[model samples]
Target chain A: MNLRILIDRFACRFSAFLSVCCVALLALIAVGLIYKSWPILLEHSLSELLFSTIWSPMKGKFGFLSFIISTFQITIFSLLIAFPICLLSATYLVELAPRSILKIVLPLIDILAGVPSVIYGIWGVLMIVPCIRDHIAPFFGYTTSGYCILTGSLVLAIMVVPVMMHLLIQVLQAVPHELRDSTLSLGATHWQMIKLVVWRKCLPGIMATTILGISKAIGETIAVLMVVGNVVQIPKNLFESGYPLPALIANNYGEMLSIPQYDAALMFAALILLAVILFFNMASAYILKRVTKSIT
Target chain B: MMKHKYFKKLEEQFFFGLMQLATVTILFGLLFILFTILWKGIPNLSWEMISQKPQGGFYMGGGGGILNAICGSLLLGLGSTILGLLLSIPIVIWLNIYAGQYSRNAVMVRTALDMLWGIPSIVFGAFGFIIMLALGIKASLLAGIVTLTLLILPIMVRGMDEVIKTIPKELHESTLSLGATRWEMATRVILRKALPGIVTATLLGFGRAIGDAAAVMFTAGFTDNIPQKLTDPVASLPLSIFFQLGSPFEIVRGRAYAAALVLTIIILVISFLSRLITAKYQKHSR
Candidate 1:
C-alpha cells in the first residue's frame, strides 16, 4: 500500500511538472524572439521601424509600415467578406435548417476546415487569380497580374469561413432553447426570436469568434504569400499588389544571412506577428470566459 | 397597420432568402474547389509520379517522381505526431486529473494552450529556427519534426482535453472508491475510456503536421533526396506542390495538382476515419 501511494504521488508530481513546462513554453518563445531581435531594436528607433515606408535593405533602412498596412488590409477585408456569410449560414444551421441539411452541412464544414492551406493557395492560383486578372479586373477597368490584395482576400475569406462558421454555430447552439422557445411563445416570429433573443445572447460569443478568426487570418503565411503579389508597396487599391509581414519573413529569412541586421529585422517581424496574435487570442479568451461564466 | 405588417413580412422573407443564398454560395464554393482539383489533378496523377524519385531538373519539366517528398513527409508526420502525443498526453492528463478542472493552474495552462494554438505555424517555424541556431543545429528532419511538434502540441492537447473533460465526475469517484490511486485511475479508467478520442486527436495532429508547409519550410530545408538520418535535409509534398506550381513548365504544374490531390485525399480520409471512430466508440462510452 505504501509503495503504491508513493508511486501515485510521484506520477502526479511528474505530470504537474510537465504541465508547467507547457505553460512556460509560450513565455520562452516570446522571450527568445525578443532576444533574437535585440540587435535590430538597438540599431533603429521603434517608431521608425514600424511607421517608416522606406525599405532599402542595403542602406540599412527597414520600414515595416507597408507590410503592416497590407496585413491589416487583407485580414480586415477577408473578415468583412467572411463574417456575414458565416453569420447567416450559422443562424440558418442553428435556428432553421432541417436535420437532413444539418447532417450534410456539418460534415462539409469539417472537411473544409481540414483541407490544407496550401491546397487553398493552389486553388487560388489556378482559379481566383486568373478570374481576377481576366474577368473581375477587366470588368472594373483595371489591369493586374492576377496576384493582388483582392485575390489574397478572396482565398483567405474562403479559408476562414468554415472556421468562423463552425464557431458561430456552436455559439448559437449554446443559446438556451428555453429562452428561444419563450420568445416565440410570446407571439414573436421565428426571425424576431432569433434576431432579438438568440443573437442578443450570442453577441459576446460571436464577437469572440470573429476576433479569433482575425487572429487566424493575421498569422496565415504560405497561402497568402503564394496568392498576394509580394510587391513592397502599400496597395492603393484592391487591384494593386501588396506585401504582408508573414510573407516578408518567409520570403527573406533564408537569404537574410548575407545582409547585416536582416535576420534580426525578420525576427522583429515575427515578434510583432506573435504579439498581435497573442493579444487577439487573450482578448477572445477573456470574452469567452465571461460568456461561459454567465451561462453557468 | 396592415401595410406595416406586410412590410415586416417582406423583410423577414428577404432575409431568409439571403440566408439561403449565403449557404448555397458557401457550399458551391467548396464544391468548386474540389471539382477544380479533381478536374485538373486526375489526368496529371500518374503511377510514375507516385512510385519513383525525381529525376535531374524535375522542376524544369524533368521526368521523375516525387517519391522522395512522399517518404520525407510521411517520416516527418509520423515523427512529429508521435512526439506531440507523448508530450500532450501528460499535460492533458495533468489538466484533467491532477490539476482539477476549475483550478487556477489548469485554467492558466488551458489559456496558454489556446494562445499557442492561435499562433501561426510560420511563427512557430521562425521560433524553431532561432532555437536551432542557439543549439548549433542545422535545418534537417530533426529540426522540422521539433518545429512541427510545437505547431501541433496545442492541437493534440486541446483535442484530448475536450474528450477527457466529458468523462463524468461519477466515474472518477467510483474509480477512487474502488481504491485505485489517481495515477492508476488515470491510466486504467480514464485512458481506456478516452482511447477512441485519443486516437482521433492523434490523427488530427498527424493530418495537420503532414499538410503544413510554412512551419517546415525553413526547418526542413528542401532537398530532392530522401533523408536517411535525422540530421539530413528532407522534402515535403506541400513544398513540392509549391515549387512545382511555380515552375514555368506546364508539365510540372500538372504534377502540382497531382500532389495537391494526394494531400487533399489524405486529409479527407483522416477526417472520415475519425468520424467513424467517434461514432463507433460513442456507443460504448455512454
Candidate 2:
C-alpha cells in the first residue's frame, strides 16, 4: 500500500513538471518570433517599410503601402460581397431548413472548410479566371485582359463564406427558441421577427463573424496569389494588378538572393501581417466579449 | 383588426421570400465552388499520374511520381503527430493535476498556449528557419518535423486535456485506494477512460499536419526529386501543386491537379474515419 501510494505521489509531481515545460516552450516561441523579426525592421527602418510609395525589390526599393492598400481593397471588396450572403445562409440553416436537409448541408459546409487552399488556387487559375475574362468581363465593358481585385475578391468571398458561416451558424443556432416563440406570439410575422428579434439579438455575433471573416480573407496567400495579377505597382480600379502582403511574401521570399535586406523585407512584410491579424483578432474578440456580456 | 392582419400576412410572405432566396444563394455558392474544384480536378486524374515522379520537361511524361511526397507527407504527419503527443501528454497531465500550486502564473501558462494558435504560420516558419539554421540542419525534413510538432502541439494538448479532465474523480480515487501506483492508475484507469479522446485529438492533429502547406513549405523547402537522406530537401504535394499550377506547361499543371485530387480524396477518407470514431464514442456514452 505504501509503495503504491508513493508511486502515485511521484506521478502527480511528474505531470505538474511537464505542463510547465510545455507552457514555457510556447512562451519561448512567441518571444523568439517577435525578437528575430526585429532584424527586418532594423535594416529597412519602419518608415521605409511602411510609408514609401514603391516596393520593387530588384531596384532595392521596399515600400509596402501599396500592398497594404491592395490587401484592404481586396478584403473590403470581399466582405461587401460575401457577408450578406453568409448571413442569409446562416439564417436559412438555423431558421428555415428542415431537419432532413440540415443534416446533409452542415457537413458539406464543414468539408469545404477543410479543403486545401491550393485546390482553390488551381481552380481559380484554370477555370474561374478564364471564364470570368471570356464570359463575365465583356458584359461589364471589361476586356479579355481583366482579372483583378474584383475576380480575386469574388473567390475570396467564396472562401470566406465557409468561415463566416461556421461562426454565424453556431451562434444563431444557440439563440433561444423562446425568443422566436415570443416574437411570433406578439403578432410579428416570421420575416419581421427575424429582422427585428432574431437579428437584433444576433447583431453582435454577425458583426463578430464579419470581423473574423475579414481576418481569414486578409491572411490568405495561395488563392489570392493565383488570381491577384500580382504586379508590384498600386492597383487602380478593380481591373489593375496589385499584391497583398501575404502574396508579396510568398512570391518574393524564395527568389530574393544576394540581398539579405530583401529577405528581411519579407520578414518585415510578415510582421505587418502579424500586426494586421492581431488587430483583427482583437476586434473579433472585443465584439465577442461585448456580445456575450450584453446578450444575457 | 382582421383587415390589418391580412395585410400583415402579405408583408410577411414578401420578406420571407427574399430571406429564403438569400439563404439559398450562399448555400448554392458553396456547392458551385465544390463542383468547380471537383470538375477541374477529376477529369485530369489517373492512377499512373499519382504514382509517378517528375522527370522530363512538362510533357515527356515523368521523372518523379508523387510517391516521395506521399511518403514524406505520411512520415511527416505521423512523425510530428507522435512527437507532439509524446511531448504534450506529459504537460497536459501535469497541468490539470498539479498547476494549481503555481496559481499566479497559471494564467500566464494558459495565455501562452492560447497565443500559440494566434501567431501566424509565417512567424512559425521564420522561427523554425532560425532554429534549423542554428542547428546546422538548415531546411531539412527534421526542421519540418520539429516546426510542425510545435505548430500542432497546442491543439493536441487542449484536445487531450479536455478529454482527460472529464474522467470521473471517483475512478482515480478508487484505483489509488486499491494501492495502484500512479503510473498504473494513469495507465489503467485515467488513460483507459481518455483513450478515445486522445485518439480523436491525434487524428485531428494528423489532419492539420497533412493539409498544412505554408509553414511546412518554408521549413521543408521544395524539391522535385525525392530525398535520399534526412538532411536532403523534399517536396510536399501542396508545394508541388503550388509550383506546377502557375507553370506555362499544361502537362505539369495537369499532373498537379491529379496530385491534388488524390490528396483531397485521402483527406476526405481520413477525416471521415476520424469523425466516425469520435461520433461512435459519443453515441456509446449517451
Candidate of highest TM-score: 1
lDDT of 2 by residue, B1-286 (tens): 9998889888877766766787677677767766766776788776666676556563344445666677677777887899998877777666554454136555456545655655556566766876776677867778888888888888788778778877777887788799776578667777777888888888877777776777787788866666777777777877777877767777767777777877787777776877788789889888
- Which candidate has the highest DockQ of all? 1
- TM-score between model 1 and native: 0.99
DockQ of 1: 0.82
- True-contact fraction per candidate equals 0.76, 0.54
Q: Where does candidate 1 stray beyond 4 Å?
A: none
Count of residue pairs whose backbone atoms collide, per candidate: 0, 11
True contacts reproduced, candidate 2: 0.54
Clashing pairs in 1: none
List candidate 2 stretches off by more than 4 Å.
A1-30, A37-40, A144-146, A290-296, B1-11, B58-64, B100-111, B161-187
Q: Evaluate residue A62 in candidate 1 and report its C-alpha lDDT on the 0 to 100 scale.
A: 93
Q: Global lDDT for candidate 1?
A: 0.92
